[model samples]
Target: MLQEAVDNFVTSIANGEMERSGGSRNTIMAYRNDLGQLCSHIQTLGITSWPRVTHEHIGNYVRHLRDEHAYRPTTLARKLAAYKSFFRYLSQKGVVTTDPALGVCLPPVERELPQIMTTEQVQTLFQLPERDTPMGVRDLAMLHLLYATGMRVSELIALDVEHFRAQDAAMQCVGVRGNVRYLPLTSAAMDVLDRYLQHGRPHFLRDASETALFVNHHGERLTRQGFWLIIKGYARRAGIEALTPHKLRHAFAMHMINSGMDLGSVQELLGHAHISTTQFYCQLASAQHR
Candidate 1:
């Protein structure tokens, strides 16, 4: 019965307005967990129908999450978004006339300044010995492209061979929500990418591989988890503390913004459909100005 509701919700999402959002399978699964928890909690309180849910019931569920389950503010906020989305789904389907989660509030979260590597630190990190080994060459290209383009890890991994134009010094990539945008590559990034494609990638290929820009030792397209593990290894080798792939993106955005590129251009380059989404980086820049 609960599975049916989840399936219906997901189907509606697919057939309805959210179809254009290009949400991933992982995001849909998260919404399922969140809505399932709310439904279970409501059922435990003897409330079964969606129409029976009220704002107070929503508050109770949030309290239960915070006090009983000890969810963090960010987790709580995500759960709230999930619930809101679920109710919105219900409203669109005429299951409920009112959206009970509409007025529900999320806990305030502090927006902290994003960490970025200095230009010198980036130079030093990229200067590590290149053994002409496959992994070494791939790592060099990966780090260079990350900082150069400010692409998210998922976007980077999704890159295809045809998306890049070597002679034109440009690449087109899809961002979060599947919006495609073009970026002009720096000379340094182009050099590393050229080397990786010509020499390094051929060494990694097995039988009948596809046109993915980066591949693992097995000659398969790299997974997000695989990329993270590789990045962790490289960060340790470079003697950089707590370095993750996103820090490179932060460094890229920070450097671009600080170099006086307007926020609109940054937003477009990052393929953020909403200006509000891109504004967070501006907040990070402002914190540094303080």
Candidate 2:
């Protein structure tokens, strides 16, 4: 029965149901990991079926994760979400008459400030060599755009030529769960975008792909991995140690907070569904001011 449950979950994910429900590959993998951990815990108690899961079993699993595994509160919350999703799937499919994990509650997660680059460091990062070479030009634009808009790496990669309104100094991003948000471009960002569009992109275009805004020399859309490499390269060139793409996002958020934007506005700009997620930037900005 446990095997059947796993099979059903996998099949449902593959059948586009998960995507329709706004689940990404990362979300699906996380759920798989969480459910796998639960099953492993259940096996320790000799329970082998979805129907055999009891409230006591769910409680024990949570305790085991907290007490034995010492998982962080956020990790525990993610695991709980996985369990809830799995059980919901089972109930929807009529494989389970009742959901044992329905009443389970995740522990509260502590809010932590993400690492951000200093304004000076941001300035230095953009001081990279301005060469007319394709790679150099693309790297400059990528870094500029990231810092300017605070766009997630995935959102940047998913961008298409049509998403930009270059004449209006804005670009629209379809963020998580397909929510569209408009990002007003900074002068620097607009300049870089203009240069890339005029000089860099035309060199990369091919008949096979035309819609993607950022492309490699091979004319394929710039992948997340490729973007990472570009970021790392620029970091090294700028002599900035331990910098990552996310640091740019952190800096952007904190800068906005420091500039007196409220949490709700920042949340909307970042495409966060919940204002609580954006509140972390406020904390970081306050700490920096202190």
Task: Predict model 1's lDDT versus the native.
Answer: 0.83
Q: Write one digit per residue (lDDT tens) for candidate 2, span 1-290.
A: 78668766866776678557665677767767778777787888898778889877887789888999899888888888777778888888887898888888865787666667888999888877475777777778888888889999999999998998888899999996899999988998898888888898888888645799899888889998899888888789778888888899888888788888878888988999888888777767778779
Report lDDT per candidate: 0.83, 0.83
Error of 2 at 28 (Å): 1.6
Q: How much is 144 displaced in model 2, in angstroms?
A: 0.6
lDDT of 1 by residue, 1-290 (tens): 44466668876665555656655777877877888777788888887688888989898789888899898888898999888888887788788898888888975876656577888878877877383887888888988988889999999999988998887898888877877888889999999899888889888888554788889999889889999998787678778898888899889888889999999999888777789978888888888789
Superposing every Cα of model 1 onto the true structure, what RMSD results? 3.9
